[model samples]
Target: MAIQFIKKITFNHPQSLLSFRLKTTSSQYVASRFRDATFEKFMDHYKNLLKVISIQDLILANPKNNPPSVSVDFINRLSQKLHLNRGATAFLRKYPRIFEIYYDPTLSKPYCKLTPTAMQISIEEAAAIQNTHPLVIDRLTRLLSMSKSKTLPLRAIFKVWRELGLPDDFEDSVLAQNPHLFHILDAHEPNTHLIKLVGTTPGHENFTAAVENWRIMECCKDECSVDRTEMRYSFRHGFPPCMKLKKNLRAKVKEWQKLPYTGPYEEFTNMKKRSKTAVMEIEKRAVAIVHEFLSLTVEKTVEVEKISHFRTWFGIDLNVRDLFLDHPGMFYLSTKGKRHTVFLREAYERGCLVDPNPVYVVRRKLLDLVILGRRGLRSGDHKLSSSESEEDDDLLEMENDQGDIL
Candidate 1:
């Protein structure tokens, strides 16, 4: 693949060599990852990664404050470029362990060893931290009694439950009442294609089956620490690290719980770690913000319209394929009323579009003529360049405050 070592010193400047400020990111990375993988392999690897790396996650992790200001769309395009989304989630869901595995906080920290022994975490705090339902305390206590052994095979305990004719639906009811617990029990489900229910539990076989291949584990420790150590277990699962947006969403959504979820912190943490779709969460919010900020609406949807050609407000039309070869910038849309004036410029050539222009136009809303380029921003405080000549000069790269494309 053709590549260039983009220097990282351009964030505070606009004219750096690798800094061409545009609305899109390059699609080359996507093309490369997809080149040789079989349909199945590509679907599993690339699609999962895309679901794992959301737009919001990308923006949050690689904020403009950081050096590698990669574009979220570019990342998605890369995943799609590899032709991985073809099979959708079913194929990838089977290989839940493709990403890293983490532990459940109700157990021990993820790296700790898993012990078959189950200890009862106090019901009081469990309601708060675990998102546990208030009605299930008795069931929990009973389960804890069955799990007291330091190394009881989970299968054995469930077998005993089954022998006792304790219905699996009873467990499901408890889980349904407490989704938090379900997240915990199901967290390890994502690590393998299909988890086999084993050990010495009776009424627990079907109970265990319900949680197979779910992805729910925590990444941090403080959230998992209990006042008592026995309250936890060593957690483990095969789930990718939570993307940025997932964390943000967890932070936002978990706060609104009606009753405290009585699941392990690892469970909440694992919910924080979902498929690649997490990354787009923030950008999706930002887009919403921009729409509200600008009072913009999708005035109309043009169906069956051919994108055979488009150009800038200047009325120049170019085929989509030759957009870059002719314009050397990027493709952009300016919406006024029901019509979206299509155009190509530096952005179309180099690469993409989002609501806020680019992070450089960091305000939640963008108005007036905004030109995104690879130009490095000057100081954290910036004044929009009033230089009309600069606006017209697409070929010229932006310079840092030092006035060099360094």
Candidate 2:
């Protein structure tokens, strides 16, 4: 899909890069326009990582089996749904350190199970989730508080639970423990559930955005003379090396960054004027809200469509894509797979999270396992044929190339 998108663009010169000229609802042309290959590669890697993790979760979901093994036939039947490009047997065989295929004599068929290392990593992930329960609750509460009604659909929350680092049994494990802060009530729609914030929790009433904290810390670290008010209204910008901002565009962005606007956690619905200045401030507030949302995620990123699911609830009326494109320095849009993913530019350095969370650390371990493939297996445990060894080397080389950009 990414390849096809690239092919459709016509570059005028050899140095020309992928660019878009999107018009926002206010009929203003977006000044920033360029793609960042680093982020695109980052999203491409996660695309496969997410698929591997999903398959892992599916196998782990069935705890009835003593060792949690599933039949190879079952996975084969659901390969398409699992989004596996290759056959199930081949895919499982590729990541030998994470999965093991063995013959089940009683069933007269082969079954798949997590290898010891993978199982250990899963255990660690569970522990990390438990240890970070309070942080998870805080993130969830902030998410709910951003909405107009201080509520979000249960189904929508389920869609982003993984990104937000919520546990599998969040309803019972997280929400049930925080009755004072949250409540699950049936929505007006039949069979729908809504998770609503009861009121402002005592300590959380003055919740500060992650981005805001970072800005202040950066200012303090540099000992800059910039006023606190100006810092409050400003955001850091980091454009890709390939993008060259025009002189006029740079000046405009500098002015825009200094514009005073409502913070993400503050109220903005009171301003309903249709003047150009009012519209711009509202748009800036929308950007701040999205920025804060991404800041709360474990990886500082989310699928654009997944975030769009909460648009109405968050009172963001502009096109999400346009907003991301308009501020290339603050956010990056990656159309690497079928979905578009937006990354918080400041949260990541190169291809890694700047301040890794406990959950992200464990998840990275799983990703490493996938990237290492059979190389991670014990030398004497499994022997690869010449052709298989060559294949593994090729896979490693490809991953290494992507790693360089990440």
Candidate 3:
């Protein structure tokens, strides 16, 4: 109702001026009457004014006099910068891999892993055949369980299932028949095997049994094996054991207070998406931390793989964190609440590529792993049914093509 809310519209008629003056006086009086404690009471008045006056213009002009600390305009800008659109919530909820990202070894942090070893195996055997290896089967089942949930991301399910080289759309079809897989996986523990390797309780008997059956199917390829009931009991690490939840990541972060860092950065990087502005903010903060650490030349960063997730925004993916190849130190990016920034810690171990170019190399490596595995499967399938050997054809094609690229 403020005259400022009316913008710079020229008064065409005498009646319009009278209306404007009345509105201005009322708006000024209302603003003067508004107190700090009455923020909620005055929101409706501003919202109505926002329709006519652009938020940016009002900001520049300093209208309302009593500006809310958080405005709809600010939220709109935040949504744009953070890439929070309609699909983001569903995508976050639906991707089990996204959930896996949350299952960091740190427990409380977003943890995701890249299965480089499985990519290695896809060249030799189908996952159906490879499930014969107990360790491999256990790993496979862990990957499979992720997809069983209706809440799971279909894309992640398909990708993992394909890499395992099961029949097309196997996970989806399986889920279509049994919809409860989602709820089951959501409740399951990640270290169930290691737990069995330790022990289980009466309460955990059900969890133990499911894990055992899943392992047997993967290792023995005997999903329908009749003696699973006895086998589940046989391997149980006896007794009324209790899970100590305090040993988890949440507790650790709480105990640590704040992670050791230079400033305005986190100790880990695990955001679902990376925007240009956010990534830059993280990089700047990380670089500042690195500058501080490097300033103390005597301090060593024992290198290991600084871990990260491939975050896709607008369909292009990038790894949002880095660390030295041999150092225990790491620089990670974390998305917590409205802010996402890179973190640096001296103790977190990850093989960091100090070259500052991990985002490109890591993505290419991941893509090559997928594409090469897919190509090998296709080539193998063709070779089995063909009269002409595919290897011979590949050799001839390579010879002919080598001349052009060279």
- What are the models' TM-scores? 0.15, 0.85, 0.19
* Candidates arranged by lDDT, highest first: 2, 3, 1
lDDT of 2: 0.82
Candidate 3 on 137-195: residue-level lDDT in tens?
23233333222121333343333332233334344433333343322232254522110
Q: State model 1's lDDT.
A: 0.26
> Under the 3 Å rule for N, CA and C atoms, how many clashes does model 1 have?
84
Every model's Cα RMSD, please? Answer: 27.7, 6.9, 27.8
Q: Model 2, range 1-406, lDDT digits (tens) per residue? A: 8877667565454344423433244323332346676776666667777767877887898899879988889988988887777879888887887888899999899989998989999999889989998889989999998888899999999989999989999999988888988899999999999999996656678789876887779678757877767677888888777787899999989788887788877776657688988888888989999999998899888988899889989999898878998888899877665667888998888788989989999989988877666663444667654776767777888888778665
Ranking by TM-score: 2, 3, 1
Error of 3 at 297 (Å): 37
Could you tell me how far off, in angstroms, the CA of residue 387 lies in candidate 1 after the best superposition?
3.6
Candidate 2 vs candidate 3: the lDDT winner is 2
- Off by more than 4 A, model 1: 1-183, 186-381, 397-406
Give residue 322's lDDT in candidate 2 (0 to 100).
Answer: 83
Assess each prediction's global lDDT (C-alpha) against the native: 0.26, 0.82, 0.30
Cα error of candidate 2 at position 42, Å: 2.7
Q: Residue 110 deviation, candidate 3, in Å?
A: 50
